[model samples]
Target: MQWAYLLGLVAAATAGHVSIPFSRQDYSASAALVKRQASKDITLEALNNLTGGGYYSEFSIGTPPQKVSFLLDTGSSDTWVNSVDADICNNQQLQATLGTCLTTFNQSNSSTYQLVSSDGFDIKYLDNTEISGDYFNDTVHLGSVSIKNQQLGLALQSVRPTGIMGLGLSANVATREKYKTIVDNLVDQGFIDRAAFSLYLNDLESDSGTVLFGAIDQKKFIGNLSVLPLRPRQLATRSHHSMSGYWALTC
Candidate 1:
């Protein structure tokens, strides 16, 4: 299930790139578009937000007119951006160097902004610096899709680079009430066929990482796989237990 959450984060951050045009002067003509087959390799790129956070499988964000990267974490439930102008705690020194804070979009620019909840979740380090906030409803654009009033986390704090986005199975009341997830938005807009996606995560040092939509890359697996039954209620209960244990150990 943790893998599922991380896969969601990767799916949310995945972006399409235009292939470089080949020249006919020196090289033979080739296909204008390059489609990569799915594999088990972990994709690598500079996740702008994950600078000092750690070496993580990275993906690019194509929204709000900014490039940001993040660690594919499934343990958290909201997404946030770190602000450079906010005050920082002594213990947050390490994260301070990871990435630049985003300041372009603020409350004033969003016309339909609504804060979801205040008592959502909190993350802190031993140095006393922490990040906390609740889910928020706002418009987020990815690729050609513009998700209106989507539920996302907004963090208010002086931290390193861009904030994080949670991809856990646990959903906030508002999120559940509205049935919103990055995948859901994509599906609704017809960018992807379904809410299910697959991630090929390799060792941190490997240069291969990819996310598959609608179908898995058959070559990556040893044999055929079967679909599992949906168990939303059970998944939610397990998420609660796991989160409680994680917070207790970290706090």
Candidate 2:
């Protein structure tokens, strides 16, 4: 049986390339592609647990690779970084206090950056922190490898000085109106074989952890991983919209 190559990461993204297998099961067409096999788990980078506040990771965006730190949030579906014109970053009071929200993105600096929408991203969280920005597509480097033309948000009116890299569901949320997300591009652009990623946070008292995008570190756990089925989207969404889109185990 032929297997497909896995792409990108959690902490460290892979530097490998993805190629579709030529011969499919359907046997409808001729062998135009090679029988590509799945590559071993590729690593991207490690997550730095900042004194137990939250997990932060480094990502280089744009052509020249401007490094930035974004808090990895799974609760929200939108991934947004502060723009150079971000209100909080420019404001005197909020500027000094914006911990962990460091490094705003500049579109003009990157040669590969492309503007998709002028006002494509606007989101408000449960705490009423509203973020509004333009939609942009650029190259995002997980570690050494790159995911090309990944669409992301550039926040201009954010409360936090730092940015957010949310890995939640990409549809029917704040970002649904915008273009495809990094994760979406990760799969479509052949970064990963499928739409699955594993986050290895290690354990409590661990200062450093890693996020595996398209692969899993089998050595992290011993026993076989148990598969839990998720609740139906329609049933889960019927009660509350907020609780529905996310992955929830059904007993």
Candidate 2 achieves a global lDDT of: 0.60
Model 2 agreement with the true structure over 36-129: per-residue lDDT tens digits: 1112221212111111136567788898999887777666766778888888777876544433345888888999999988988888764334
Give candidate 1's TM-score.
Answer: 0.52
Misplaced by over 4 Å in model 1 are 1-64, 83-85, 89-130, 158-161, 170-179, 202-204, 230-251
In terms of TM-score, the best-performing candidate is 2
Candidate 1: tens digits of C-alpha lDDT, residues 1-251: 11222222222323422111111111111122111211222122222122233323322232343333444444444555432233432234533433333332354445666766754535553233366555566666543456566766555553444454444433532233434666556566666665555655454344445544443544555544544433324222432542321212211
lDDT of candidate 1 at residue 204, scale 0 to 100: 37
- Give all TM-scores, in the order shown: 0.52, 0.73
**Collision count of model 2:** 14
Candidate lDDT values, in order: 0.41, 0.60
